[model samples]
Target chain A: MLLRLAWRNIWRNKRRSLIVIGSVIVGVIATILMDALQNGMIHQMLFNQINLNVSNVQVHKKGFKDKKDINNFISKPAKVETIIKNQPHVKFYSKRVITFGLLSSTDNSSGVYIYGINPSQEKSVSIISKSIVKGKYLDASDGREIVLSKALAKKLNVTIGDKVVGMANTPSGSIGSDVFRVVGIFKTASSEFDKTTVFIPIVSAQQMLNIPGKIHEFAIITDKYENADIVSKALQKKLGKKYEALSYNEILPLLVLQMDLYKQLLIIVNLIIALALIFGIINAMLMAVYERIREIGVLMAVGMKNSKIFSMILIEALIIGVLGTIFGIIFGYGINALLLSGGIDLRWFAESLSSFGVGAIIYPKISLENFIQIITIIPLVSVVGAMYPALKAIRLEPVSAIRYV
Target chain B: MEIIKCENLQKIYQDNGVPVHALKGINLTINKGEFTVIAGPSGSGKTTLLNLLGALDKPTEGTVYFNGEVLYKKKRRELSRLRLENFGFVFQAYNLIPVLTALENIEFSMMLLGIPEKERREKAITLMEELGIAELANKRPNEMSGGQQQRVAVVRAIVNDPDVVFADEPTANLDSKTGDNLLNLMQEMNEKKQITFIFSSHDKQVMERAKRLLILKDGLLEKDN
Candidate 1:
């Protein structure tokens, strides 16, 4: 009977109930949208970083991470490659030689990092060939051919079929210089990579730098990203102290750290929104108690105990919470779909984000877990918010309450 | 048998730093199955004494015994429980819960007593019929006339079958004819059900229906007959 009374009481003032429900809906929608956007952007970033830059895992000389000089290379590449090929989880691997060199073409001269790879093997790891904007990509059989980023090619006044001079330090402490024909111009979405990297054939780089039968780094691809750490540990044990295995997280710690920070920030934002909605609900309930003062007095006077009065008020709050949460979830999903379809445009702030190698358009993606959290949090906010007003009604004296207008 | 006894009861109100004695050493007793009226003008300690007797307020001094148990010695929660089981009340303004229908308002007291729904509904319906407001059972307090609302309030008070019914100006909001009818209803219920009916009122109709009258003047009992 008390439950029936409480349920009926909520609809007695339709306007007040709507105000509270509206606030909850707004709060839930905002939280869902923000959470989805953050999750989507971070997922996109991690995907790009792993596939384009650091293939799930990479193997380097034991001390190469601390100092990537001309001396750090796998001396016995044939044996290490054979071992990696035989591993069960290892799906693909690419041998690459990375070094800093100066590029010069007539009037232009700039420092650039060169990545030398077997073209066929590199293709299995990254989509660099598909990113070629101008000219033809270098093939494994092509001799003395290289690919330059469009930005770097433009700065050096070099094009396809044009010869450029590259200079780097050799293991013998002597300067190695060579002439290379630009066969392709690649365009990475990130400005940093587009302006600074030059790709060349691994054998040609090995011969020119006088490091025959050696490779500096071997990027590995696995069946699943979550198994990267497991495969890396297995590789470390198999290769012994000669090689060090690094996962994507270890290679790009800043990105991983930023993702963690984003999660915390999103939680705080959601809490603030929830708190604001709860305050609005509390305000509405308090006013409701005041408006029904005489009614409450009458219930007490007719032999209804103070505890029953308290429970009835609490039940009213519970009903409000359940109704508000149902509408909130619906509203949240609707807003999420709208935002997801119409991607957010941040072209004006592209330059600012470009500094961190992130894109302008942010796409929001929500998971089941996040949706469940939103649903759970709203009801808790309503129930907790209703407590103060219910207690206030319970504390009211029957005489005074009956006298109130 | 004495259902209510008060000994030298006192109640004081602080009015802007001055002590105003609302009840001053008043003594009274009410017998079971009697229609008793505590009659006085406004601010003559009738309501104050009624509140103390109903266990709604703590007396400034002395004690009240209801059915041989001292009420003032019980905890607030215990007192509330005792009041729920032992007393029903009707106020001057016809305090019917605006959110509930007339039938629901009467059934609320039985619900607090944890009575089963089917039984409570039958009792409420029977009481509403007895009070001649059975047709208005579905109407909210605001939807009914002042007299109809007051009668609903009366049914709500006695629906729990409490040992005592405390009514503070039960007919104050009704017309003279309605007020007279309401008093007669209380007297009839007292006679038929053997349920004690106690009221604090200045209304002549309420005073005339009383089998026992306790008159108060200047915060003290002046006459008892």
Candidate 2:
């Protein structure tokens, strides 16, 4: 009977009830779309950084990360490479002889982070080969090939096949300079990375830096980033000593921090929207209570309990929330489907996005967990919204209420 | 035997920080199955006494004895249950739930008493059939006439077999013929069902049909006979 009364009461003013229901639908859909877009943005950013700039995992000497001293290069490169090759989870691995150096082209010299990579293995591990704009990637056995980013090539007034002099401190504490011809030019989303970094053949870098057979890092790509942590931990345990294996997130904490920050902001935004919705519901219900004052008085005079009145109003809130959530899920998924297929183009902000190494286009994604979580929150918002109105309703004085003119 | 008795009943209404005395030092007793009327002019405390007797309000300084139990001392929830179990009320307006059908309204109080749906529906239909308004069972209030609505209200008041039925200006909105018909129906219910009928009204037809009349003037009882 209470349910019936509540159900009928909401329909007493269809427009008013529909307004609340509509607001809930709009709020939930907005929440879902925002969550999906932010998640997609974070997902794309992580994907680009891991696949192009940081590999899923990297193996370094124990003290190498903190100091980055040339002397901290891997101790047993050959043995670790063999163990890594046997691991099925490892999709590709490349040894890098990394060093901070300066590159000069006849007139200009700029400080650059240099990576000496095995061309063939690196082709499979990084996006550099595919990102090439001019000339060809390095030969497998080449000893003197180099690739310069478009930004760096421009900064040094050099282009493809131009001669550039690389200078760095040797392992023996002496300065060494070598001239190499750029064989290719590549561009990445981040102009800063392009302007500040270069790559050379592993043999050429080993000889120039005076670090023979000792690579500073072994960057590895896994079948999936999801499996990277387990593989990294397993390899860390297997290697046992002298080497520390780190997943991409652990190696690049800044990217992970940004992702977490986006998630937190999304939650706060959702909470604010929900709070407003709850208040909206409360206001609507209070109006319903006020309009039906005489009816409520009649009900009370006939023998309805205060708890029954409170529960009926609360049930009305639940009904509104449930109805709104259903519509919200439908529209949220509908918009997500359309957006997922074509993606939301932020190409207008391409330049700004490129500066941070993030893609301008985002494909909104909705996870089942997040969808269920939002669905569950709607009713709770409704209940919270209904609280004040329900209390007001049960507190009516039947004696005067029945005589209300 | 006394079914209801009130001693030194006093009611004060605080209107805008000024005390408006709606009832002052009135005492009364009502026996079972009596067709009683509390007759008064406007602002003469007729409705105030009805509200107190129906367990709808607590007197400022008085106790009401209902079936030898203290009505004013019971908690609000206890009062609600007592009202549901023993009393029914009909206000001046046809206070039918706008959303409900005639039969649904009739079965409302009984349904709240935990009566099963089938039993309540059967009883509602039987009562409507007896009142000759069975055809109006599925029609909401908007579809019913004033007289038909009042008839449904009367049926609802006694459908639960309440010990007492309280009506406050129940026929005020009806025409003279409908008012007489409604009074005739209430008199029948009192005689046949052995239910006490108490009314707060200034209607001549109601006063004429009353077996006992308690008249009030200026918030004070002038006569009870």
Top candidate by TM-score: 2
DockQ, each predicted model = 0.52, 0.80
Model 2, span B1-225: residue lDDT tens? 799999888999999999988889888899999999999999999999999898888788778999999997889999999889899888888799899999999999898899999999999999899888999999999999999999999998898899999999988999999999999899999999999999999999899999999999877889998
Put down candidate 1 lDDT per residue, A1-405, tens digits, no spaces: 778888888889998888787777777777878788888778767766676658888999998877888899999988888888887788999998888889888869889887788899988887688789999888883378889988888899889989998888899989887889999998765678767778889888887788987999999999998888888888889999989988888888988899888877776776788788788878988988998988876666555677778877777877877787778778777877865657678789877655556568777778565677677777777878888998898888776677677
B-chain TM-score for every candidate = 0.97, 0.98
Clashes of each: 0, 0
Clash list (residue pairs), candidate 1:
none
Ten contiguous residues with the weakest lDDT in model 2 chain A? A365-374
lDDT of 1 at A123: 89
Cα RMSDs, all models: 3.1, 2.5
Query: Could you tell me how far off, in angstroms, the CA of residue A206 lies in candidate 2 after the best superposition?
Result: 2.9
Candidate 1's C-alpha runs over 4 A off are A1-3, A75-92, A234-241, A302-325, A367-373, B116-119, B122-134
Q: Please, what is the TM-score per model? A: 0.89, 0.93
DockQ of 2: 0.80
Cα lDDT of model 1 by residue, B1-225, tens digit: 999999999999888999999998988888899888999878999988988899877899988999989998997677778777888888888877787899988887787888898999999998888778899989998899988888887788787778899999888888999888888888888888898988999988888888889999989999998
Give all candidates' CA lDDT scores: 0.83, 0.88
